[model samples]
Target chain A: MDLIRFPEMSRGELRALRQTVDGAFREFTRIWGDPLENLFAPLARLLTFLENLLIDSPWILVLAVLAAGIWLASRSWKIALGSVLALLVVGYLGMWEDTMRTIAMVAVCTLVAVVLGIPVGILMAQSNRMNAVVTPVLDMMQTMPSFVYLIPVVMIFGLGKVPGVIAVVIYAIPPVIRLTNLGIRHVAPDVLEAAEAFGSSKWQKLRDVQLPLALPTIMAGVNQTIMMSLAMVVVASMIGVRGLGQPVLQAINNQYFTMGVMNGLAIVAIAIIMDRTTQAYGRRLQKHAEAGK
Target chain B: MSAPQEQGQAHGIEIRNLYKIFGPDAARHLPAVKAGLGKEELHDRHDHVLGLCDISLSVPPGRITVVMGLSGSGKSTLIRHVNGLIAPTAGQVICGGQDVAAMSDVRLRAFRREKTAMVFQKFALLPHRTVLENARYGLDIRGLPAAEADGRARRWIERVGLKGYEGYYPRQLSGGMQQRVGLARALTNDAEILLMDEAFSALDPLIRVDMQSILLELQKELRKTIVFITHDLDEALRLGDKIAILRDGAMEQVGTGQEIVLRPANAYVADFVREVNRGRIIEAQTIATPAAPGAALPGFTVKARSKLDRVAQRMVEAGAGAAQVRDPQGQLLGVIDLPAILNAMVNSADAESEE
Candidate 1:
């Protein structure tokens, strides 16, 4: 028996497809605007409160944290010495305790971003419906006035390190999510398909295929998040964050030029350390995935 | 052991009346499905597209079924169903006695974890993990301890001939090496069914052939039920036990390599067959019959099942007039000469003419 084949799509069908896509794009852009904007200060306060809770034993915590940071960031003794000196100067400037508090807040915020960001990125990569939903959400997160994000958190959590950390997380999370999604989507479809044929479950596929391939991008996100968190810290101190931001803000307010410059240097040092370490980790992941191939 | 494995052996994937329409109106327009009158119909008139239209087929145990078509053919969508990567709008994918379409999230997860493996054209190894770790990832997702997963991953890495470079990431590897790792990753999962979506199309010609042979070697022993998707007629001929041609989300034809080549049911199927090197595709075991001539004082002979391509090549290269054929035990079976080949060629043409 003979079988029949369909002809190329008719012109009318192409027009319909174009319309559907155009309509979707329009809705997407429309949804990208801020759904909320007046919640920055309350969010900043909430970050401060959160910071206070995690900073119970400032000196010891600072020492351990600094050492670990050195171990992870730049293992060279000179860099470690520099890191230590940077901290001692902050202390001498009467910002010792505050430095520790900010460090704690930054650390907690980084952890939160990593934890929340990866799964969502994987979900976006795996589902068309989910991605369609998330694309607008991501667009809004990235495009909304950075300060506007803080308002809701400030209102809910109230001023302090808690609100400050919240603000940092909000700013820092988008890159991580965006990069992670890109990496997963770019993973060799063949490799993931191979994994599927091997009977990998969704999580298995993500952990095995998607997450591993995406680690570099996710790591890039981490680096971005860290830099962003540091950037936001200065902004956060305007509310009540005690660490470097507070001193910098106070220095600016009081016209203490030397103090402002010195505090800014400290934040810069922290940012450099976090950025370098995460970048190194990302490179390592890229190398690892290549090895699989 | 025999009882458990026998009970566990799957009949492989069976897809039935699958429909994946892109627009929201797909379900609503269900009763109006017609060839050339689907998404393209809506799309041409209203800019809508129906991605899939009632795709159905069964991949039997230990068989390689190639889904062939150009882009927009819905071949990829059909493969996706076998592994439950995309749920059909309306249909069932039965595998290992389970209706994949009806599976709950947890069941789907379990199915993916244990039953299916896939390979893509773009060798998707995890960038962060070392080759060993990437291989272990499948095991890891199933809750295997890191140490145990690593142990098996190491073995697969070696199997794919990537022994010393366990620590390198996906980016550091060459295209071919990455694909090897892809193979190793799937091997590690040891899933009974393997789905490939143009997995080698991205590779260079030489590397693609090498990979094909490697796949052959792996499948010879593993005997996994494999459903491979590709537009390349040569690839389909080389790898498939059966081939299903899809055009616009509908099956054009499904048959064994010989069946499709010798008797294409439609013009679309014939179009693909005409492009293949027939001598390379049909085998001695397939068309060779006992002729009176190959009785070379009687014992020595090529297996009747020897691939015709191999036999034909030996004939051309050695300038031999005829080739002897044998059976399963290598017993002298028959002689096949130029006439047999010419006969096969004519039959193929007749099939195409019928189409």
Candidate 2:
């Protein structure tokens, strides 16, 4: 017994295990990569279309639309004006195209995450077994190094916007999924019983009662997903995603301090705008629960 | 409004030999439970909590049958059985000649939609939905068209005195108003069987009385077969045409308010009725002496259905020693003296036993 030096796998054995796993994954990717890339072609098109729509639109038009959207979602003229001013500064700083690209990528990533996450969350909430199985998977996804998964993703999709989107979504989706499950599970039992007592089928109960009541919490989850996706922008740029993150990556490599800070500030501005708008929207949804207090 | 003839054909619920054991392997413990295993012993030995033991009740059509018990006495569990919200470990809940426990998933959903509505103690209105929307929830679940559901919901909202608060959310309203919305929601379903699980228990005492009056007033017209659960003896007396008392997951007694109050089935039931006002529950006819045929009845006559307290007041007002108790048809049934009323009012069953 080698108690002092903990027993471990032999170096040769470890090397053999690594090579075997790598070889198997390489073979798997060769066999399945084209089909997987084809399946995501439409998503790539959607992302490219959105990116062009944002970047190619007249600068003032983009600014006004974003301002209007912020106003509508947040119902706050202050937030809308602040966001518009921040975007103007970013534009004046000559980072307009990069900021737009980042916004588009984050938006798509958040949408995909929400669209996929909520159903999985609802399933997890409905059954204890599903919850048990999915909770650990979510933990692993969140805790594992992001670069560890990127290798397989890169091998399959080759390096581009689709792989970047997949990477960001994997990194960002856990909050929405976790929060959606939590929100649905936290609905008052009596209210759920009332729904059943009124002959609400499972679908009816979910759509009418669970979804509406859980909306605020789910909105919070979406907010968190957007924030997480934005946080992953710099990391995603390493996989050839063109965004504000690219300049930051270049700045890091070339040691240009101002470029790094400026691009980093642009990401922060977008994060604040998204965060405020969604938080305000969630509060508005819960206005009924707060009224007459 | 349904015709009286059609209303007369409404279904009464019959819950028979229902047993609910809450645990995994609940069915395996049924033999031991059926062999007279007590609730505590079953819990200690088998790790199975007995929810209800051999509960059998007949809830008459167009009348309120209140199941009275403390929190853990399985009153809520018993009400849930009628709606098939909880499947019994054994036995049947028969409504309209069909066993609720035996219903298929689709059939049970249809049955609940078509035949039953429920009111909850916590006023479980959808906080997101406005009062009108909450009221219309049952109809919406039944897939009623939006316009019709809204119209019917509006009518019931007004009927429940929540007319102006249609757009108000549940949290914005007081407990009483929220419960009114709950009642409107249940009534708008147009369900024959209305299940109220401690519906008014969450309200203040005065508000509870007001809600009871509202229920009684509605029942007069709607005549829905209502199963109301309560731990408050006064509420049971006020609302129940037939009251079933439960203790420790077992039925202690089942009878009219007067029957339970005047002659309790056991010491446990006697102890329960001890604090109840006998004057309010006991009827003049129940404690009256048999009068000879063709005998001259007292000038002061009270209806046999008149509660003892009312009978005493009338006798006192008339300055008569006793009053003749008359049936609803105004035919004299018996004579009830003031002394007897006083005796019954002051003397509990335990006191009588001591005497």
Candidate 3:
């Protein structure tokens, strides 16, 4: 090792380095702020109960999930059959219980994200300054890589299910905001002009014309939000979220070929199931708008 | 430009030197704008488009004034000033006695809610609401109880022949039907001044005629002051009590149908009238005089308001020496023979036949 010595830093230089270090540390703390009643304890409890409960009744959970996939595939017996077979295979190889736990987590996480995310997306779409300010922060949240987000979230919320959910939301919310802004901004000018001519006030125009017209695209955003939440499931396992991903990771480590394959199939099934259901809902909304027009 | 004087007439609207220029560069160019410049003169001087230039016209109570122009002729901009949807860059839009251009936002809202309603070209019924609900939206915004608004909306819907379709969404309706809903939405408010910006322009031609008939029936009953804008000359001739021909943001002429067709103020007005079927537009009451008992009269019953060309056609059709013209009360006033029709056409053509 070449041991190199430099002249000791002046006091101001030392202070400047301290300030930079302090600023970065402060940012780290802010990024993962307060998550117990807000974050960790309840989430872990919910995750543990779901994980344990699914272990108690894997077959029921698996069949219940196939129902949505069937409904969404919409009379496609082949796709429905294929989806059900996937769930059965996951069950046969003994990862079915863990898969259900992951499903429950995703369902809970997506619901929470939409409720919170939509209003924020609406707000972001509504104001230019807010969109300008929020968009970069969202970009940072998404682009920071999956592992970097977990450390602070895990540190503050401290190792459990709540950290996992929060981490997923942070990762997934950007698409919802981006697409929502784009959708509302893209409503036809002629349509909006008609609303104004009708003497609809600002609020009425937004509620009646803007929102209804922008709905199809917003639903597309919602679908993307849900897909992103699912992507977070596998990454969430490192923070001790004991879902299907844990079994997949364990089987990979242990070289249990049959086990990894079954768990992987279950993950694929969950993604396909969620994707189809949300897409169906989006189509229904599109039809509703067209019918209204 | 004429400074406005109080009209002893009881009109619902009186515009005085109302100007709408594009923006900041307008004031700098004002010195160069004449009272009314030719189209090319305007294009060269403004370096900006003139929308409604120093327009001063009126919409009389119980009458329809159709402001006729081509697409960029500022017909829509002129109507917006009447309802206070937009303020003029110069001059006043007087409704009853209040100046719409000077009304505060709250007052303008109150005025729009109470005294004026507008129909748009695209039939902008709310997609989220059913026909009845969309029609009631204006009333609902003014804080009327739902029951009251819906009751009134139902009546208007029935009036517009949309009774059975009240529950349908706008998308469920056909284009003509959707336009009826837009019409019903405006009519439900029962505002005195109805501003229709190409109200039936989006409908099919046959459907548009039906809508015009419907509007005529409504006007007979309600007697509202109506200011309608259209690029179509025939629609104007059919519906207008007074039609103002606009060319490049200036009024070419403002007069009744016969006044424009028989005696257009300028060539711009003449070209618009030339293509219109004068026989269909000019009424028997317009051109008829007290019947001359001893004249060699044509055997056709023609109206005094009948255009000279039409009376001539009737004369040709009848193969008579002259045609008898009548007024609204069935009084035969004057004889229009073939020579009279040909002479009138030739002499009027001499004045307006453009190079």
- DockQ, per model, reads 0.31, 0.78, 0.32
lDDT of 3 at B331: 69
Any idea what lDDT model 1 has? 0.74
Give me the runs in candidate 3 sitting further than 4 Å from their true place: A1-19, A22-93, A252-255, A288-293, B1-11, B23-48, B127-134, B140-158, B161-174, B289-347, B350-355
Model 3: per-residue lDDT, tens digit, A54-124?
A: 66665666487556556664545555666677777766777666777887788678766777777777888
Error of 2 at B235 (Å): 0.9
Model 2 chain B scores worst on lDDT over the 10 consecutive residues at B1-10
Q: What C-alpha lDDT, on a 0 to 100 scale, does residue A27 get in candidate 3?
A: 75
Residue-level lDDT tens digits of model 3 in B1-355 = 1314343333479999877766558665555554555545656765555677788997788799999999888888898888776677788998867898998877777777767778889886777678998899778867889999999999999999998888788889888998899889888887778889999998999999999999998888788789999999889988999999887788899999878988889877877777766656655555444556675555677667666666676767777766677778986577655655554555455446663
lDDT of 1 by residue, A1-293 (tens): 43576566889999999899767755654554233223444544545555565455566575667667776655556656666766676677776666666676787788778889877887888788998998898788777876776765565555666666667777778887888888888877656655655556666677656776667677888788778877878888765667788878888889999989987887787776666666655665444333224
Per-candidate TM-score against the hidden true structure: 0.71, 0.96, 0.81
Model 2 DockQ reads 0.78
- Sorting all predicted structures by TM-score, with the top scorer first, yields 2, 3, 1
Task: Give per-model CA RMSD.
Answer: 12.8, 2.2, 6.1
Q: In candidate 3, residue B129 scores what lDDT? A: 76
Q: How would you encode candidate 1's per-residue C-alpha lDDT over B1-355 as one tens digit per residue?
A: 3223455475678888888876666666666665446666677765556667877788889878788889999888788877677777788888867899898877777777777767777776655567787777668777888888888889989988899988787778889988888878877877888878888888988988998998898788878898888888888888988889888877888888778887889887877787666766676767766666533532235667566667766777877667777788767666778677666655556466788
lDDT of candidate 2 over B1-355, digit per residue (tens): 3323354478898888999999999999999999999999999988999999999998999899999999999999999999999999999999888899999999899889888999999998998999999999999998889999999999999999998899998988999999999999999999889999999999999999999999999999988899999999999999999999998889999999988987889989888888888889888888889887888777788888888888888788879988888898877778988888999888555576887
